[model samples]
Target: MRIFDPHIHMTSRTTDDYGRMAAAGVRAVVEPAFWLGQPRTNPGSFTDYFDSLVGWEPFRAAQFGIRHFATIALNPKEANDPRCRPVLELIPRYLDKDSVVAVGEIGYDAMTPEEDEAFSVQLALAVEYELPALVHTPHRDKAQGVKRTLDVVRESGISSGRVVVDHLNEVTVGEVHDTGCWMGFSIYPDTKMSPPRMVEILRAHGLERVLVNSAADWGKSDPLLTRRTGEAMLEAGFSEDDVDRVLWRNPVEFYGQSGRLDLSETADTGPLFEGSSILRGGS
Candidate 1:
């Protein structure tokens, strides 16, 4: 089964993980700009991080035959840091890049005032860039986070169709479903919803604009969760087309709206991009 994970933080993962994902039938992925698993001290840090996403990361994924794309934003967790807030100013430059598919991993983290400001600002960026937004709903008070996230998106002047509210669960899926935006679920081991639960949601809700991802990153997340979800769907009697729609086509339909998703071009047969090559001077 072909796969396209809409929100995995590959920056924290290894090249081995990339090989494993490609071997597992992952043809493409989007690595949203997110907190670096630790506080970033300044905007320069964000600048370099953004450079790597647009430069180094895509080159890395391509070597393993995976099409990589990224989203740019000041993540909610760091929005509260006065020092890190200037990263907002640096976002616009990166949005214009071809590899940047959306403005994302942006939404409430702690639901603080700073997070609110950053979220509102980046939504405008998504509108200006004419790209889709991949929103990360909070891990706690999830229902309220989704509610507030919808309110911000509704007021952002960007159409709900251009937004994907991610990290959704059973309790939060109902509200996100009611909205016209796309629904995203992260299937993980201990943190987010499980594959069986995700299947149940699909059974109860039906798949239209739904996207499922491993969200594999620095945690104990599995990069093969997309394949596992597809397997569960088949075991539960969903046809190949049904599995294909959720794991692959649905993500294409959503992120493709950006006009920057080029999985074909992304799979070019070449050495890594110059100076960004992971295959040089090493074993």
Candidate 2:
């Protein structure tokens, strides 16, 4: 029951969460650039954030023996802010870094014209950089959002197989099934698909290109939901190999398109990332 959480927000999580995830069999994760709950005022904020994604987060995950990779983008919510739009120019710098596996969390938030432009532009960047994409469909009007998402993906000229439309439920999974793109589901404690529900999706869809994640963030989410979902699959009579394909191999195949995923065991280093330590009082 090894797991690769294809979409999670570990930047907002605690060091304890990392230990728990590793114990739950989560060996790897991809954290996509997303909104900070509040609006970011300038591109400099994103610069620092992106730096930590490639730098500090990986160091922290390594302490728990988890390999952390990141995706870079100017997220949909902030794309509407004139001051933050400059972050677009800054993304290419991170995209070239080895740790960046994709360009992502880029898609419609409010579905404004501003979101439309940012989505199109970043999808173009993914094409140019030869990285995969992790797209976030709007939380509201999900069915319509997925339809529009597939439409924009079609126009971007990037291979559909390289894109993942995430945060989907039963209502929207079929929309992406035959599109040549991968489907993603976030198993949450509440307000999203639960373990039993996700098992049903896998049962119906047959786990060819499906990715299940915990998507834990700075909210009431659970980092172990990925593990819990795997348990549910077994209880529902899915073979161990079937569980492996959804939780592990599917994400490997999707993000592997980047040619940058390094699943090598991350060696634990001295307690410091740029003079900062995950320890207190030099423990």
> Against the true structure, whose lDDT is highest?
2
Tens-digit lDDT track of model 1 for 27-106 = 88999999878889999999999999998898788877788899999999999999998898889999989989999889
Return the lDDT, model 1, position 239: 98
Model 1 TM-score (2 dp) = 0.94
Q: Positional deviation of 44 in candidate 2, in angstroms?
A: 0.8
Whole-model Cα lDDT per candidate?
A: 0.88, 0.88
The list of candidate 2 runs beyond 4 A from truth reads 266-277
Per-model TM-score versus the true fold: 0.94, 0.95
Clashes of 2: 0
lDDT (tens digit, per residue) of candidate 2 on 1-283:
6888999999999887877787678888999999878788988899899999999899888777788999999999999999998888989889999989999999998899999999999999999999999999989988898999999999999898899999999899988998989888988888878999999998898888898988888889999999899999999999999888888889989998999888876433322223234665488
Cα miss at 73, model 2 (Å)? 0.5
Error in Å for residue 8 of model 1: 0.8
Q: List the pairs of residues colliding in candidate 1.
A: none
